[model samples]
Target: MRGKLRHGNVPLRGIAIVAILLVIAGAATASATLLFLGEQPSPPQLAAPPPIPAPGPEPDHALRDGQPGEVGLNPAPIAAAQGQLAAGTQPSPGHPHPSYAGEVSLLARDGVVVSRQATGFALRYADAQGPELPAEQQEKTQNDTIFDLASLTKLFTSIAVLQLADDGRVNLNAPVADYVPEFAASGKQKITVQELLTHTSGLQAKIELWRLPPPARLPAVLSATPQNPPGAVYRYSDLNMITLGVLVERMSGRPLDAVVHDRITAPLGMTDTGYRPPRDKLHRIAATEFETDPPRGLVRGEVQDENAWSLGGVAGHAGIFSTADDLAVLGQALLDGGTYRNQRILRPETVRAMLTNYNTAFPRNAHGLGFELDQPWYMAGLSGPHTAGHTGFTGTSLVIDPGSRSIVVLLTNAVHPSRTWGSIGPARLEIAQGMALALGPPGHDG
Candidate 1:
């Protein structure tokens, strides 16, 4: 019956089977074409790709008491760093004693207090060559103990000048002679206010301002001749700041200490910070070196900077006494863009200008207005373009990292026994590194 239905030789069933086989072959070819060239073959379904987490806001910058872990920091490293710092304060066998007699260190991460350590003695010393004192006579260091801020006073002077600038009383670009005609002497008439802050004013690094009478010191600083042409060199000179102190006074018509207190410390609530701490607070002040030349033995309750002392303990280059706690507030204020707790001491723009490096011509000297910028020798892990700080000759240091919103204050009486006790660079680096490590990487807003 299949052969009868067929037109020519092949049977109908045979033709049907042949057509089915051809249809199957065509489908295989079409599938191959789709798989390789025409279109994609259906593949196995996969689980949806995991959602990426979105970044969050920055961590809170208002300092509060918290453990390192609370601020997303590792506790072990911070503890280890503290231990190392403590060890550095003690005398090791075969190693000449500690870098400093005592220290008070505070570390904050994202404005959270992670560590506060007070070690050694503030008065466990005497003259460099004097016999060791009885332990009973030495006073142990405390967190609130006041320290002579030494060159850190420059920061205050710089702030005062900036405050004047903010008030429109001072012009940074104007020549010093504009505000201070006496400054025109010694060919310094062309020097600008900014040149002094950047330490590029070519002023001599130092003068025995003490050698001159108190009345004459100010004149001497003003009459100072530039060792190099103005803005030609980067020289960290106390005279530059001294001249600024004079400028601040001349423009504001107020004493340096008075202006710093009324405008800075008082507003910031830095109760324990100021020049010439009161007589009642003298006992808590660290003792500095013995100056036989000036006959100031175990110098205590007085400014440590010789020139500043000679100028009656209230000068621009030095003489401010402060505690680690007080200095932390100042550091935090700068990090907060010159305001703290609703009190705006400096405009944000002024703060930025003060911290912006102007000595780009001299890369090694990365100086902002009054703050030293990115000094690796002391800033350690905290050293960066945004890191700004200053080291006091009295062994006090302040390091502020805007990126981390962290502040590290290390106050020491390295000058307690003697200013010749060796450098505190090692201890500074170690302390700063510890704090930086605890904070980990930046932008960990969680």
Candidate 2:
């Protein structure tokens, strides 16, 4: 039984191929039979799926029972974001986003790209050598250029867990300890895999992995205990994907990076997305905001999440690098129910499961397994019950709207020199709004 996409009543399809052949005992016998009776021939039977229906109003909004409607980014909110973009210009009294070299923002709606603009690049801070990016290095900041997605790495981690569920190697409702025995050390023994995916695992939000001496970190994780009663509340915990990473490694018997690369990145042809980007590709890499607490002046060609860095830059929570183009493919794949270019990565039902909002009682952190559902302040006007996407603290986000059959990806080095400046919420939300405005709302009745 195949389930249709819950967001919209998108149809499901199946594909099968068959070939038929007949053998003759001998050439002489065949010739003799041909002279008498024509070779035995039977009409080959074949089957084909129905043609795709023209998209109309989505037929279903799959949810547990009563998932709330998501907020949408309106023209007003979008105008406000653009206002913020303008202020991100020459540092003025109110502008928070310092003009520390930004990317060109592009708004795409429907199948059309509506708006594109370059901003926040002229201003700069001293580099490790206290030198600014020369004019040549600045070319990659254009609209066509790609920005590295930071901790948004969790999106891939979530996909991996769903893949395991599809393979029947793991069950979302089952306790995660079924695979990673060490994860059961604390009271988390009874926590279901779904709980972790939804950030309701009761695990500590973070352990300051970078602060601990290298040898003590793993021990720290093994000894982690729940901060709240499991499944009783919602708490965004990096520990969730961290555990998932361990589970993926244990089940696949390969490092998380290898498993993700082979299953998610490589098959999708996301050539620009991977863990620890190669040195050859580093030249085009955008510089993240500098940091001094860890004694690292400016972070480039390195993982940004401290926990991921502590884990040697391949944690399930945050050790992948990707660009807008590569991740846009990922977004499109999700929109297509996991297949792109004739390669089926995820079944329609599985994709449905990922987008279903499981957090009903916990309202603030609305989420599904690896995907965040309907949050308007960050989602801007794009929030809807069927809307789903995720954000990385490193100025990266992916938003998919089943109703529009559209996706928006924004990548920036918002934290170019420090995490202190301000939230890049406007930038992320503006990109989605630009796309929405470009696409325009559907229907003529209004």
Off by over 4 Å in 2: 1-90, 96-100, 104-123, 127-140, 143-146, 441-446
Model 1 scores a C-alpha lDDT of: 0.74
The collision pairs in model 1 are: none
Name model 1 segments beyond 4 Å from true.
1-62, 441-446
Cα lDDT of model 1 by residue, 113-169, tens digit = 888888888887655774568978988889888898898899999999988878878
Worst lDDT window (10 residues) for model 1?
17-26
Lowest lDDT 10-residue stretch of candidate 2: 42-51
User: Candidate 1, 379: how far from true, in Å?
Assistant: 0.7
Error at 18, model 1, angstroms: 84
What's the TM-score of every candidate structure?
0.84, 0.76
Candidate 2 at residue 11, lDDT? 15
lDDT of each: 0.74, 0.62
Cα RMSDs, all models:
24.3, 15.9
Number of backbone collisions per candidate: 0, 12
